[model samples]
Target chain A: MESSRTILTKIFTDYYLGAAQAKKDGKPIAYVTAFTPVEILRAMDITCLYPESYAVVCSASGKAGDMIGSSGMGQFAGDLCSYSLISLGMDHAERLPYGGLPEPDFMVATNNQCGTTLLWFRLWSQRKNIPLFMIDYPTGSENTDQNEYVYRQYLALIEFVKKQTGRDLDQRVLAQQAANSRAACKLWSQVHVLNQAALQIDAAKLANALFPIVAARGTPAVCRYCETLIHEHSRENENAVIAAQPSFRLLWHGYPLWFLPKRYPSFNDDRFQIVLNDYTLWWDLDYPAADTLESLIRPYTSTYLNWLPQRRIDWTEQLVRDYAIDGVILHANRSCRRALAHVIPLRDHLLRQGIPSIILESDMANPDYYSPEKMNSQLESFKESILAA
Target chain B: MTAVDPILKNCRSMVLNPHHRRAYLQSVSARSCGIIGYFSNYIPAEIIAAAGFHPLRLIGCFGSVSGPALCDPMCSFVQDFYATQCSGLADLLTGLVFPNSCDSLKVLRQVWQTRPDGPQCWTLDHPVNTDGPALLYLTSQLRRLASELAAASRSTVSDEKLHAAITEYNTIRGLLRQCYAKVEARRLRYSDLLAVATAGLMLDRNEFTRMLQEFAGSSLSQPLSGNPVMLAGPLTDDLELVGALENHGACIVGDSVTNGWRYCSQDIATGGDIYTKIAQHILSQASPTAFDLHRPSLAARAAELGACGIIFLNQERCEPHVHSYVKCAAELEQQSIKTLLIEVEHGRPGLQARDLMRIESFMELL
Candidate 1:
């Protein structure tokens, strides 16, 4: 009869308790990323945190609006990508509220989502004085007949990990982990499919997505969490919404989901269900490794970012269709130019494809760059466009 | 077309197209006027269109399109003007436009923000269209600009006129989108697009539209070969650059640059919900590459645009995009996407020929 919050408290406590143990043992507790995958960092028993999740935490609250405008956020204002700003803004912000950069033995970053995060991480790690490991990704453009390049990165990552930990990764264990992660993602994808039709996004279900969509990618835990989320979604009841989801369903592109949660959470009502997010989709697809530790870092086993040029367009088109999403909201964040870089073209692309996309402008971590009331009005137009359609 | 067609060389003449003088320049000639625009992307296309004056891309070519001048930083193509010193393309163009993008373009604004011997140049002062201080500042600025433009043109933009202007602008946007779609699908070559984008120089929406619509209707077929080169370098890849690619039997396909995609949008609605339209347009235009830091970083969107191989171009000593080009090269390399980073400067003709030969070699790989 333990309450859900109580159970979550326990889970969080257990993880943190485990974290406390690592702290006691002087083992590093680095913040890992869905920018790459969960298993790569988990393999070494390092305490991991997903900035994507922290971004979500800010998304559910109005905290992100306040968190922006830090000196670090301003440094990247018109230069890097918005997600980098979000990660940096939040990463730096977390140090103030959630305590400074977590103590970590080593830092692992990836070039999966446009090398911005990797670049940002390089700067971040350098500033932190931590050992930095990068997982090279395959080019996302025209392919050479050689698939070896893709998997080559996987092997490289494996070697890097092994060198750092001084313990060779067992191929059998890595394959098992990959299988589990992929299975979890499949189920996560299915759960996301449920609310594809403007179904209301249940908060609990969204919370559950963290596991399969994020934590459990490349593992059975993802599938289990997805199934549980679906069950929880079915049992949920909502009457406040016009139907179950909003009249218009949308996806918040880039890192502003965290920045503008308070401004636009109204869209999360029962009338419309936003079943997927760029943040969630990235990790679910970019599981860094599959077979042996060496095989995992193979260049052919590239990241989602550099594996194919049309990957974002492909992903966006697929998500809009899969989720039957009506529109896209590009968080034209100031700091993370990388995230917002192609947003206009993507908007243009979506517009050409007849998707009603809107760019929601704001600084992911800087309040000086946002207007809640005005943003709400803009979203209203977006929502109205959905209703009108 | 010669071995190197004059894209950057005659950019100013292209901007100051006679139509602009026959219409707007007569007015500017009669009386002084303030001008505002972004260096490369915006380059006062719409403003020139509205003011009935000539709008220029401001690209410069060294005496020979043969050298490193073409490879200067992205902004160097227009705002930097190292080539203007030699090419003398600066004679036709006057004034500047600075909007929010990268630090390189922003600094250009500072340089012009206090020009003592030029047209009363102004900054549009538009920020990203998001709901932040930038938006608020830009909203106020837009209102001021509407009035300023009216004063400059000596014709107040009535609410009706604004609405019509917006719709007309939207038409241009729709047409541009059509062209981009064709480009995205690889149906059109970048060289074919040069005329259309060039037509925007000093041409009004109507004239540019006529040229664009004609091209859109016509069948100007160019093939993108096996090695569909996706290049990012200095400001060399202008219309002239596109033509150069086409001349070499390479179709300029997709691109990831401030002016390439970030600049796409219809005119803001003239009347109701004007702020929203302007907001959206500005936000869409402020993609990552807009800001040019000394060592700028790669935009994820560039990585998202798949090309067989990437060409990183930069102007020597440009500072910003050069660093960005290097970082982008490393990133592209990590993805197993081979990259050739080229450095160029204004007034240098020999370097461009070598770069072209080098490009031919790189294209051979794809």
Candidate 2:
């Protein structure tokens, strides 16, 4: 009978509890990025710690700026990836709020995410003097042979983990983990797909649901989390009615401002509501069945950031059309350069289709870099433009 | 001032004059020679040359601001290219190739691909790990790139052509080694040697070799002075920054930057499929790109140059150089070497005075 919020709180609380216990249990921990092949690590029975997700926790708790300040002195640059800076700072600190992360026994990452994470993870490996395993992904999908290379790297990573942990990667376990991952993604996709067509859920509620969707994929918890979220939305829509009959369905681009969630009223408001977000939907990518190496790695290879530019644009255009989006509000986050790369070009594309869009400049974590007054004014102007269009 | 050699004068003109370099590149296209831009120094020029395309290194022009048009945290180097694209200069190229070196460049590849007016763009994996599998993967990537370049240039890059390209580039690399060796030995002025090297990357392969060979053999040596320091970083296209360091009584005896010594230090192995050889050669060198684990060679090169100190100047938001410099500095410090780290936004005019003062203060300590 627990609400989704209560269930979410228990999931997060359990995550930290397990980490604390793992440290005491002499379990080997592998620090990883969100996009890493967690299935393999799970098969190897190594505890995975996602530092980037921890950075979000710190940022939400409003300690990111102070944490980053300490690390940015001389060892790290102020302009380096804020997620990395905050993580490094928290690592070097004597004490932290949510408790310190366990010292990593090893590190692993794939370049499918921004190349920054590869470097960020490398720094951790060097600092801790632990082994680092990597899989280099070619940027686009044109060369399927690139997957052959990745499959080889995957085997190499398995060899590395076996050498380090004295555990072998069982094909049976890998297949099951892959199946679990596929199920999680399928459920996650339903939430976004439903929201795109019908504004059944609000942005804030979806944002809360996306935390577990990002952090705890390929697990029973996330599968249930998604199902519970979808059920709640369905129940809410049973007797639900659009309060204002919003004239414009806008798409929110980039990471949601976690620290300041109330910036825009909930999507239930009469004004322009954010009907979709491409960034959140990126994690909802469905993975093929893991019958072979290619199928096994399909979950990682089919990542949104790893897609070709044309393919990304095509999918986005389809989403915009299906949702009947009036405009797109791209969060020009000061911390994330990869997402900002397509801002102008996408704006121009939407413009050609008679859609009005605006780029709201701010930071995802570092509020010092964000101007609330400026954002408010920009949003006001954007709303006016969308209405006019 | 010493009497400048004629070849040195032309090299200096090209290095100092952006318009002259632009005009020369324009003329290369008029002859129906395909002009392909390779984004970073890590890309093997022999592949493009083998495909009958001029492998023009595309470091954007130095004076413009990207102006709040894109994300604030994006590197200015990529931002400058975006700004230049809007200004219609990217139309001059037959194609563009980007090495998957860092986040900024990777994102720039996507941005360029989205532009309707942008030239044909291809992204290649420059392996971070120098292991056997990494080299093998890079060989496949290079072969793919050569095939793409051949199609773009409307020619076939045969094995024989690739071998010839390798030999030609190796010859230039050999001369550049001698050029940098002379600078380290104080037989050549720091800025003069750099100007010649910078000009070489812009000019035709044979013309650059001819001029650099002449410049390397010339006798334009004035007595070298000032405290010698090795300059190392990600990007150093700003000659003003180099001059500022020199003006502060710190002679740049050697450098390990994208536009500096890393360009010409390594040579391809002879007698192979040539693409595999190119991958081996590129992996053979230590990259300033982040994620490269070992950099003892950088310290060794600085020590061999007899530089009393090292100045690691990097652009802000350039994580690779920033992270690498810390480890490199520690290794240098263990050898009793002094290091100064400076992070700035390159291509901004009128910030030289403050930087020069910092360099001067560091020189005073030396």
Candidate 3:
């Protein structure tokens, strides 16, 4: 029987290979941002690829530095989003990974995640001379207005995909896909809940387990992968003997440092168990089945990073309480300004709530920004503080 | 030393000193219902004007102020705004409007709302795509903003008031175009042109128009001597960089910056549903670095200005302009046009020695 980690690796590998093959077979391939409506593309029978997820894979594989250097040769600034740099650099790179991403037939990006996606996809569109469709999600606005605005874009997106691929979207197929996405989200949520009950799962493992949900959320494969993930965790929870519990059960508050999977202290240490991360819960939303497109507006627009800081504070407090989290680790990801901007206030709020949190500054995909000496020192001090408390 | 025109001197003082600008707004606030502050060029000042409130563009402040510390990686423009707000300069305004222009500003808006005694805040959701649906959505957003502004000021925005405001701004835009043409023709100094443009953000539209009229009527046509260059970037209020470039033998003949030409390059059309027209005008303008598509060709603009090179200026930690520079630089290279990239920390007092040396070298290269 394949381990959950093996299954996740295979799932991502197969997806990339299949996409490369699909491009050769003359199938339409669309590079999409993480929070885009991939369900629509799936229902239309178009191959959807997430450059962001693939960038993470490249970072984990230790090839992101070369790719970033290639991008720099093209005059892309070193401070731009590392995920974008990785994708942009792939075109100029000498060695191709996974046969390189298929030249996008078209690109779809939603600003629900961050403003960087729009710019990154625009660069791709310009480079490939392909049509790019943007789904705008206005932050810090009224919910009704945001919903109406985003829902209108969803309608427009359908027309755009049809125009690009010459394929009509079947509403029934979309409904089924949305159903699968909802099921996967529910199962993923259960995994979080299960982790809260028993800290038997490794956070690094869970981060890899998140690929299916992030990349293929509206497909049955995600639902199956999530179920398998829940099963594995449940089995561990039941069969494992209670040894020495971790001294500190911490919650990570931003994107994981994908390039430093093995060296990340929380993953390597037994005394510190990273029980929850904000990244894993980003897609743990329950969608309503009544009106698929209309319903997507609320959950899609109201992503954790998309909300006001107070809502995130409240949600973090809830997670800390529910998960019995002892301390918090805030990854002040330099590449993600939207996420980084809210960290200080969040740290202050957590401090006021009597919750100890430490901020680790590093880029998600760029290893150049990661000072292992500094990180290890900070983690050592943080562990001591946690133990003292 | 050159004799500075009184109007230009007044504009320069108002732009260079935040206290002077604040005092001016305070005096204006006493005469008007209230002052409404806005950020970004995408915000329609006509609506704020229609509400009988003074529309002041917050171009940020110099140096840091005592405030809740934002992270170091946040853009300098946002940091400067927080400095201004924390310094109590923003207290003169009754409300503030923040356009969803960039990620940093969007985060600032959310964080600003968390303040207990902060002024009434409204967000204008600018769409990335400039199409029919986007126009409709933006129009709706503008309508909502108009209603909110009216409600805050306890007034109404009649079509007549809106049209009047539109005409006043259109006059300002036309006058600014004349000033830009003078600068491009090398008859006017870029610093003086910049002072006029920056002052417009702080001054009443009518007063700004009068100031420009006086400057335009003056026979100040002295062909400035320097290597002609075009400055392009996102929002910046670094008045000294313009002076620094000229000091190093580079005359900034034209600009695509938010605080410069992009502010007054397009005028809202009259004789229509004012909201729709305002939306259309904003969408049709050369899209800012924040917007995803329809970016105006910088190389073509540089060629039209007859610039020997293009100076791509970016604020430190500004991701949008940095990303834009990559594409624009490639395009300029293909055109055999020389380019220099300069990143400055906004609100810093002066240009770094390294940057000055780079500017000198770039000037020599051109």
Candidate 4:
């Protein structure tokens, strides 16, 4: 049986192989962000690359610094999203992993994630001289009207793809893709539900498992990985009755530092284990069969990124109860304003519900904004708060 | 003093002094039902006005300390706002509105919502893609906002009131256009002109229109000296930045900044429903916030103004302007126009020596 690392490695290695083969076959490569509706491209038989994932790999491999440093001379600001900058910097960097992201024929991004991604994709599209098809996801109430608004935009996107790629969208293929996404999302949710049981693995392992889930949603690869994750956790649940015991379980809010996952557990001292994070759960979406454009637009518009704070609060409160969480760690990531800005209210609500929470100020991708000594001290204090509770 | 002189004097008083302006806002807002404060330029001020509320644009005071909750990488403008709120400066207003203009404002609204003592808040989702559906979405938001304001202020916003508000706002916009035309024709000082525009944001609509009418009708004459330059950026109402350039003899003839031309350049269509007209007018403007994938409107505005050059003042961490101005500057250079790009903190003090040198050098090149 292959280990989790081997699976991750194969997934990453196969992704590049797929890109190279697509390039050789003269297939159109569409660079997309994580929140982009890439299933459309999949239905159209176009190759797609997720730059947000590549940025994670760049940060993890410690090559992000070189990429960032080699970007335009003080052109990009230091305070902008480091993930987007690393992706932008890869264009001019002297070195990159796996020969860096290939030049794309075009790009597509949805504004559901954050406005920064929209701007980042726009800048990249202009710089790369590629046509961009953007789907606008206006924030506010997620009523039927908003769903229709997004559906109309998705139809326009289909027309744009047909015009650009010379291939019309196949409804049968879209339905299949939507069905695949629903299956994968259901399996992913089941895996999280199983985490409610005494899990043998650490939070770092859970976070690592989500990389493929984020980059390969709606694909069989994700379904397979999630199955393996559930199997592994089930086996561990029977064996580690002693090791799974902890001072208290923690519910983490905000994006994690992919490059420095160890920075969190290094100071944990086995006192607590982070049970789950918001980003991993951001994709547990359910949509109907994509026989119609409305079904296709439903999942994209209903993602956590499009949710209001009140809805998010209700969801967070549900998770806190379901996971038997003892406390919360909220990272006010400097790079992620949309996610970071709302966690304060979440923390306040959690505290009112008798769940102690701490706010950690740091950036997820940039190490310059993180201080280990400071974070460690905070962690120590947070541990004491849990003990008292 | 003559009647127009007192009008001009009151306008200058409100425009030039923050303390006096706050006092005036308190006095009028007390008499009136609501003083609806807004942060972004995309919000329809007419809705608040039609709801019988004073539409006060919140400008962060200089030298005010923001809350520690706001950390590094936040542009100074938002920090100043958070500071203003924490320092009890925003207590005079009844409520606030936040538009989806940038990520910083989005986050600022979320943080402000967490504060128990903060004013009532509303967040408007402004669409980037200006299509038919986007227009409908904005119109719905405007209707919702108007309804909410009516409930909050206990003042009904009838069709007549909305039409009246739109007409009043259109008049103000027309007078502002005339003011900028005068500045472009080198008949008005940019600093004094900006002061009048900023004052209108704080004062009553009728009073503001009266002041603008008096200022436009006045026979105040001044020599248009220095190089002709157009200012461009997001939400820069800092008088000191303009004062710095004017001190160095740079004639600010026109601008594409949010607090400048972007505010006064367009008018709501008088034909459609008030909400539809407001949405149409907002979508018609050249928004740097929106990723306008067309001919660079800023460059077009520069060319139309016939200015010798353009000065793009951007906040350090501002993503929208920073992403485009590099390409914008290059495009302007292609048109044989000089461009100066200066990075400064929002609401910070006057320009540094290096920024002054860049401005001077650009002027010399022009």
TM-score of 2: 0.93
Clashes of each: 85, 0, 0, 1
Q: How accurate locally is residue B192 in candidate 3, as Cα lDDT from 0 to 100? A: 83
Scoring model 1 with DockQ, what do you get?
0.02
lDDT of 2: 0.74
Q: In model 1, which runs have C-alpha deviations exceeding 4 angstroms?
A: A1-15, A28-31, A51-95, A145-147, A197-200, A203-208, A215-221, A235-256, A260-279, A286-304, A307-311, A326-328, A333-342, A363-365, B1-366
Per candidate, native contacts kept equal: 0.00, 0.67, 0.61, 0.58
State the DockQ of every prediction. 0.02, 0.62, 0.61, 0.55
Q: Regarding DockQ, does 1 or 2 come out ahead? A: 2
- Best of the two (1, 3) by TM-score: 3
Worst 10 residues of 4 chain A by lDDT: A235-244
Q: Candidate 2 chain A: worst 10 consecutive residues by lDDT?
A: A261-270
lDDT of 1 at A11: 47
- Candidate of highest TM-score: 3
Ranking by TM-score: 3, 2, 4, 1
User: What DockQ would candidate 4 receive versus the native complex?
Assistant: 0.55
Candidate 4 lDDT by residue in tens digits, B161-237:
98888889889989988988888888887777777787787788887887789787654456688888888877666
lDDT value, candidate 3, whole model: 0.80
The sequence of per-residue lDDT tens digits that candidate 2 reaches over residues B273-344 is 677778877887766443553344667777678888988878866767767766676667788888887776
Pairs clashing within candidate 4: B66-B83
If you assessed candidate 2 against the hidden native complex, which CAPRI class would it receive? medium
lDDT per model vs. reference: 0.51, 0.74, 0.80, 0.76
Residue A271 shift from truth in candidate 4, angstroms: 3.4
Question: Could you give candidate 3's per-residue lDDT for residues B1-366 as a string of tens digits?
Answer: 334488877888777787778788889999888998898778889999999999988874543555655666678778877876776666887988988877778778877877777888888888888877788889999998889889888899999999999999889888888889988988888888888788888898887887788787654556888899998887656778878989989888898888788877888888768899999988876554245322468777787889989887788777677667767777778889999988877777777999999998999998
